[model samples]
Target: MATPVLDKVEAESAASPYITVTMRIRRFNPEVSDAVVWEDFQIEIDPKERVLDALHKIKWDVDGTLTFRRSCAHGICGSDAMRINGKNRLACKTLIKDINPEKPITVEAIKGLTVLKDLVVDMEPFFQAYRDVMPFLVTKGNEPTRERLQTAEDRERFDDTTKCILCAACTSSCPVFWNDGQYFGPAAIVNAHRFIFDSRDEAGEQRLEILNDKDGVWRCRTTFNCTDACPRGIEVTKAIQEVKRALITRRF
Candidate 1:
């Protein structure tokens, strides 16, 4: 009788009891350090563990002071969005197996925002810009007696922007936002596009005027970083381009 061959999973399970991963987390204490610093933590994590899980372990078992925000661990909350290995991603969604296992993963707060603690950043400005766009259905008359009826085609028009989770991932990854904090950023523009292009919205012209400013959608260079970093797979650049097209067409 021949011996049974073990698969990769079985081999890994038999060979190693646990996998050790080094996480180089960015540390900054506003009261203690004049600048940001890097702190490394070696964690014996399971192969199936996620980056967020490792972070939680470090916070719970290793360091009680390590800070990061998380609401839903399934990537829907978007509160745990950060820069991992210089790329924007949701910590809950990234798996240890997908990255360079041998090398240390660098985790930092999202760029273009004020870091409150280890991986937590203040997102007030990001939300303010979102509010500035007035991201809601504004009907001229009283509320409809029933739910606003619309065809599938109408819903599909703004479907791309509807995927946003208000994570600030798109806005933080934007270069224009980095240089100019006043810029509305990708997330805000994405939300504006949602209402502006909606068939049911009656504020297209007014919203377009708001986005016509220098720091509005005009600042977007179509870099596509926002789309790449988006966890929800939204077409951020496409929506920004559509808004630009509307602005130009309406002028003539």
Candidate 2:
């Protein structure tokens, strides 16, 4: 009986595929040092596992000092947004095999913000930009007794932008954001577009006014980095262009 159980466990272990890879993460702690350090971790992982899973193994099996943020682990929470292979991505959404595993996988905190610790940056600036755009629905008159009706076309108008989960992946990837901290990056513009195009929202012009500033949509250079980095596949650059055209034409 013991031999049979041992054989079964060995068979399962052999059936599972795994590879050894190096995970290089950037470490920054103000309390520790003013300079940044890169920490390397080697772990065995399945090809199907996500980058977030690798982080978990390193934190659990190797180093207890590693720190990061994650929730829901399915890319919806956006808490695990980081720079993977020198690009902004949600750890849960990026598979380890998709990136070149032959080389050390470089995982670092997103740029253009103060790093509170390893892998987590100050999200206050990101959220403040979001709040500035007034992401919620703004309407006039009394509340309707029933749910507000919307045509299929109206819903489709802003549907792409609505997929945003406030992940900050799109914003952190923009080069303009890396240079100018004042620019309300792609994430903010994408959220503004959500309400700006909604047929029922009456505050479109007001939001547009808020965006028509020196640090607004004009700052975007159409680098296409934001579009490439968006985990939700939101046409961020296109949305920014629409906002720019709206500012020019004064049309919602």
Candidate 3:
């Protein structure tokens, strides 16, 4: 009958064939206690959606309390880097379909940092180490009116290190950084390499001295985790190795 046909159409409209992904997000409130906890959210998602989209849905529709950082919705912001399923990844770039869609996704703040709220971590220490490396180009003579001329080969020497976005992706993934806060970390060393190889920069010796400290480049054990975790595809381990070689070869 017409009634039966209408009922069938209504049922089809009401049912969704897509998968519902469950996310278990870690929650923390420093004002309440030092102990952090987890809260689970169930969201109906399209297979093509990224994890950042899922987080946006949870924050907007499911719970207003849930919090995280993201910008540029693309991977460039690097603000939403976190422990996604036990690995560091930019939330915007991580697609849900790529992961085990049937299983729940576990999201947590990046390790080796103090949680500020739900997902935000204090980045002061990370920036402090970044500043310690003297990231800017230092020249001896007066500023040239035009661009300093350099051969293509000179520019290529430090090309790999200049790709860093200051996202802290490499720094947070380092095992040495997780255990020792004093260590200069990979991001700092990468920045140092940017200028160390520059033909115009005259501060290589000074930068090498800074990196030669106990908590500096010597702390890196060459685990290559930083290189693996870097979203920009920088050769982090190689830069650190270059700095180590420079320290050993430098004439004091």
Candidate 4:
């Protein structure tokens, strides 16, 4: 006969939702091989755990060589953005149970950027596009008298785009970005929208001129993929459209 404690432990174990999930990751290492390969990792984890937790297990216990980027696992850092099961998302923000662990979860580096390793990509190009948009407050005067001021109405105009963390999820999901790397992707336009609509920003016209270039805001296809891929719940495509409208009408 089993003891009471043993019976209770057995019952709890039986009710546990732990499952063996297969993570199919697309790997690439120019130093190791020129060809990209898909590697599968079978991990035993709780259904409610995060995908990042599975990756941690794989790296800690299964294979130390499994590479990926993550910081501030709470998702604020935006360093862990990647494609999971055909959709771009932050690995730390994605839950295993929500993504259906029964089937293999496919993970890969975000598209458009050149992959440096298993899941890391070269972000210099993305940052270059961001810098090209002049994503900053450009006031035409000396130091502000007492910090630029704005009314609630003015702040609300560009509040939606201010939540961007520069994860590159929206940019990599863009079809236009994938086809033509030169196209200023949705992330850049979204950042531009934040400052372009600001009542205190004086360089809105200059920024608009930069976006009016051939590979700028006009390249957006409005497929809404960037909006869907944003982990911050930002209406990304909407911001891009606002930028386009501002360029055409010269009104923020």
lDDT of 1 by residue, 63-127 (tens): 99899999999999889999999989999999988877689999999999999888889999999
* TM-scores for all predictions: 0.94, 0.93, 0.90, 0.93
In candidate 1, which residue ranges exceed 4 Å CA deviation? Answer: 1-17
Model 3, 1-252: lDDT tens digits are 579889999998687756899998999988877899988899998867899999999999999888898888888766988888888888888899998878989999998988899889998999999899899888887889999999999999999998887778889999999996789889999999999999989998889989999999989989998998888889899999999988988854
Worst 10 residues of 3 by lDDT: 12-21
Better of 1 and 2 by lDDT: 2
241 in model 4: Cα distance from truth in Å?
0.9
lDDT of candidate model 3 versus the reference = 0.89
In candidate 2, which residue ranges exceed 4 Å CA deviation? 1-16
Worst 10 residues of 1 by lDDT: 1-10
| Candidate 1: residue 21 lDDT (0-100) | 91
Residue pairs with colliding backbones in model 2 are none
Model 2: ten consecutive residues of lowest lDDT = 243-252
TM-score of 1: 0.94
lDDT of 1: 0.90
- Tens digits of lDDT, candidate 2, 1-252: 479889988998889589999999998878899899998888999978999999999989998778899999998988998999999999999999999888999999988888998888899999999999999899999999999999999999999999999988888888888886899999999999999999999999999999998999999999999999999899999999999999999753
